[model samples]
Structures are given as structure tokens and as C-alpha cells.
Target chain A: MERTTIDLWVGVFVAMGIAALLFLALKVGNIGGFEAGSVYTTHANFDNIGGLKAKAPVKSAGVLVGRVTEIRFDNDSYQAEAILSLSSQ
Target chain B: MGVSTRFFFLLLLHSGTCFRRPQLILREIFSSGVLSLIIILVSGLFVGMVLGMQGYETLQTYGSEEALGVLVSLSLVRELGPVVAALLFASRAGSAITAEIGLMKATEQLAAMEMMAVDPLARVVAPRFWGGVISMPLLAAMFSAMGIFGGYLVGVVLIGVDEGSFWSQMQAAVDIREDILNGVIKSTVFGIAVTVIALFEGYDAPPTAEGVSRATTRTVVTSSLAILMLDFVLTAFMFRGV
Candidate 1:
């Protein structure tokens, strides 16, 4: 094959590969959160957290408000605490 | 093993020259990565379809079939994309490289290049090595992307699963760093391991027809085994906390 033909094809292949990575990142992986959105954090204490975990969806009245950033045992309060990162939107 | 290690470092020492002749590397990439795209994409689609079907079968038992997206994406991005793509790359590009080099040696082309004051290591071997390395991770990424599309086709479009839940649940569960980054890291590691093994086996083969055939076989077997072993080690390190 001509060298230019080879170069053109190689360029296409590399471009396709990059496009695939982008698709994985933006579309499939959904890494777009919190990039432009401003967020605020708040704390809530519960006697039992049940199965609530970090990054769990925080729903208010059946709508997603934000996510749980951290779930920990409160040494002082003798209860479980959840740090919620709520989006301004 | 000792001889192969020496060959590997020598290839690395000569790697700089491959960049100087950009066409050499480009040609190798064309032959390795571009040619292999069809198989990677087709195989990815089939694998994803199977995952969707199986995922639906199991999840429908609990009436939780919407999580099919999560299952397919996680499995492909986390494991199958890197592992299966690497295996296909090894068999397709890796073996081709080894066989080509072995044939050149058998035909004394490498020696002729040396006679003409050309460093075959620089002019020939390095480009192929770097080419495989560059091609591998890209191929894996394409594999993962195609697999996801395939799963969407089968799971949502055909099977009547809730499209919104499919994507939203996958997005919620699959993190950029935790799932996707770890996968990219895995494929890059596989790329290096596969390229090095393929190059070494070819360069070390005896200059004879039978030897060349044996070298090609060894390239496939060794690189496949190396990929699997390295996958285990990498998964332990990358996904331990998950």
C-alpha cells in the first residue's frame, strides 16, 4: 500500500479509538456530573442508617436531590451520620 | 526467559528510532489495529447480546430486569472489554507480528538490512513493538463501547426494558475512576505485556521454517497466558477496595 494510504488508515483507526474512549467516558460511563453544577453539603443524623451508603442517591419526595458523600458512625452522638452533597439545581 | 528479557530491553533501546521514521509505526498500526477492528466490534456485539439475554433471564426472576444495563456495562468495561480484546489482539496482531518477523529472519531479510548498514532493530522491530502497544488500548476501548451499544439494542430496543432506567442506573453505578479508569489501566498494561512477548518470541526464533512456525504458536500461547496472569494481578490491585 502507498504510505499515505497507510497513514490515512492509521489516522482513522486512532481517531476511532479516541472516539470510543470518549463514548465510554461521556455516554456509557456518565462522568459528566458535578463538572459545572454547584453543590452544597449538609449533615443528617440517624439512629440506624439501614443500608444507606456513600454515593447512594439522595431522593426527596421521590426525586433525586443529590448523593450521600459519606456515611459514618458519630462518636459523640452515638448514632449514624450521613453527609449529603446536594446540587443547587 | 533470560534471553527474551535481554531482547526486550534491546527493543526498548531501539524504540526511539521508530518515531524518527513515522511511516513505519503508522504502517504497523494500520496492519495491526485497523485491520482488527471488525473482529473486535463483532465479537463485542455478540458478547453484549449474550450478556443482555442472560442478564434478563436471571433478573426477570426477581422482576428487576431494568438493571440489565448496569450488569452489561459493568461486566464489559470492568473485565470482558480488556480481557477479550487483548486475547483477540494477541491472536490477531501479536501472532502476525511474530510470524512476520520470524519469516524475515528465516529468509535472512534482517541480516540483509544489517549488511546495508541499517539497524533492523531500529528500522523494523521497534515500529512493530510500538504499534502493538498503541493499538491495544484503543481496541479495548472500542470493544467496550460497542459492547454497550449492543447491550442497549438487545436489552431496551428488543426486550422492552425501560430505556430511562437502563441508562440512569448504569450511570449511577459506574463511576469514571472506579470502573472506567481501572479498565483503561488494565488494557494499557495488557498492551505492553502482549507487545513485548510477541516481539521477543519472534526475535528469538531460530532462523528456519519450522522454528518460525513454532515461534508464531508460542507468541499466541505465551501472550494469552501472560494477559490472563497480569489481569489477575492488576484486578487485585485496582479493584481491591471495590
Candidate 2:
């Protein structure tokens, strides 16, 4: 009976540990945050992105409506281009 | 003394034999680990609450209060979780381990076992050592999780930081492989270092009451210093490019 109690407690402890790892991976790491959804891609050109980065939120009217997907320098246009994936909502 | 210390460490190296039967190891874990878990959980909660309060006020000045979750989670997961948990483990479990073994030595129990042709190292020290090593990482993880929850409580419930923004921003910012996994690795290494030190100090202590007392004190001090130094080296190696 005592053995079972200890085993149960240790089992719970190990489960908690694994749950913490999963929380860190899924929530903090954003592993599954991006999923197949109604997303529209749009491109914008700027002289410079000014520290903007991929995965940075694209806000409109202080609302996060999309995220920056890709940023690159377009040699042909001699400008920085940013691709954004906007949620339909 | 030199010969005995080497012998103690050799026994530690082969301590994996203690795990041959899960039942023996589980008993050791119950005795040595339960208290440390409670300590880390309470400490983690308070630490996270403090971080949440502090992060909210500071970020509010810059209009970035939503970043509180990212700030609190990152700080706890990357640096504070392993470091603080290990320190607490050293003081609580580590000191207890040293004193327990030292007391046994002082009472000549270890010697009695040796006379009977029983290896005291394997029968006693190895189980305790393995218990500590197994406990540290789990304790650290619990600490981090409770800390994050504490931050959530303070930031979202009390401080009124937007809950969605707090969590979303944190998710976007922190990386599992880079931050959380590295922290787990750090705690595991710290666990090994602390348990080994505790066992070694106790095993090598002079078989006297005063000697046992001094060994307990040494367990905390030496393990703390070792933890800090190792944290520096590990942080340098793990985060060099980033």
C-alpha cells in the first residue's frame, strides 16, 4: 500500500514534468500556433523594413490581423519586400 | 582520505546499479525528493508573482505591458528555473543527504556494513545519489510551470494585462528547443553535480559529530558555487551564436 502511494506520487510528478515540457513547446514555442486557416497573403515594398522580422505581428488599428511571413530585398525593384499572411477574420 | 574519496566517486560512477530494481530507488526518491518538490513549487510561485508585478510596471512605462508573459516566462524558463531550483535543492536535499550519510558514518553504521562484507556505497549512497539526480529535473520543471502560472495570475487577473496578448506574445517570442530544452539540460547537469558533491562530502567526512555538521555546511556552500560556475559555462556554450 505504501509502495503504491509512492509510485503514484512519483508517477504524478513525472506526468507534471512532461506536461511542463509540452506547455513550453506548444504555448511558449508556438509550435502549432500557425495552422491551415483562411489566410490571405499580401506584399508590401518599403525602402527599409527597419528591424521588422518574420513572425512579427502585423497590426491594423492596433489589432493583430496578420503576421509577417517573409522579408527580403528585391534587387530588381531595389526595395525591401515583406510578405504578410492575414487572417480572414 | 584521498583513497576513500576516489573510492566514493567510483561507487557513484557505478551507482546506476541501484536502478536495477525500481522499488528500492522509488523509496529513496520519496525520502529525499518530496521536500524539495514542495520547496521549489512555493518558491516558483512567489518568484513568478514578483516577476509579473515587476515586469508589468516596467513594461507599462514603455506601453508594452502585454509583453509581461514573454518577459516572465522567458526569464523563468531560460535562467531562473534551473538556477534557483538547483540552489534550493543543494540547500535542502543536498544538505540533508550529506548530514544523513555523515551521521551514518559518525555512528559507524557504514563501517559495520563494510565489516559484514556489504558495500555501504552501493546499498546506501548510490540510491540516495540517484534519487537526487532524478528529482532535480522534475523539481525544476515544476518550478517553471508554477512560476508561469503565478505570472499569469498576477499579469492577467490582478494587473489586467490582456490575457490573450500576454500568452500570444510569449508564444511568439520564446522557442522550445533553444530556451526550454536548454533549461532542462542545465537542471539535469546541476542535479548530477549537486548529488555527487553531497554524497562525496558525506562519504569522506570524518566520523565525528562535528565532522558531519561541517560536511552538511560544505554541501550547501560548495554546491552553490559549483552551480553558479557551471551555469556560466553552460550559458556560454548553449547560447554562443544566439
Best candidate, DockQ: 1
Candidate 2 C-alpha lDDT tens digits along B1-242: 47745865787676776877677777777766776778888999999999999998899999999899999999999899999999999999999989999999999899999999978878888888778888888888888889999999999999799999899889878766778889999999999889888988998899998999999999999999999999999999897452
Candidate 1 falls in which docking quality class? medium
Clashing pairs in 2: none
Top candidate on TM-score is 1
TM-score of each: 0.94, 0.84
Q: Which ten residues in a row have the lowest lDDT in candidate 1 chain A?
A: A27-36
Which regions of candidate 1 fall more than 4 Å away from where they truly are? A46-53, A71-73, A78-80
Off by over 4 Å in 2: A34-89, B1-9
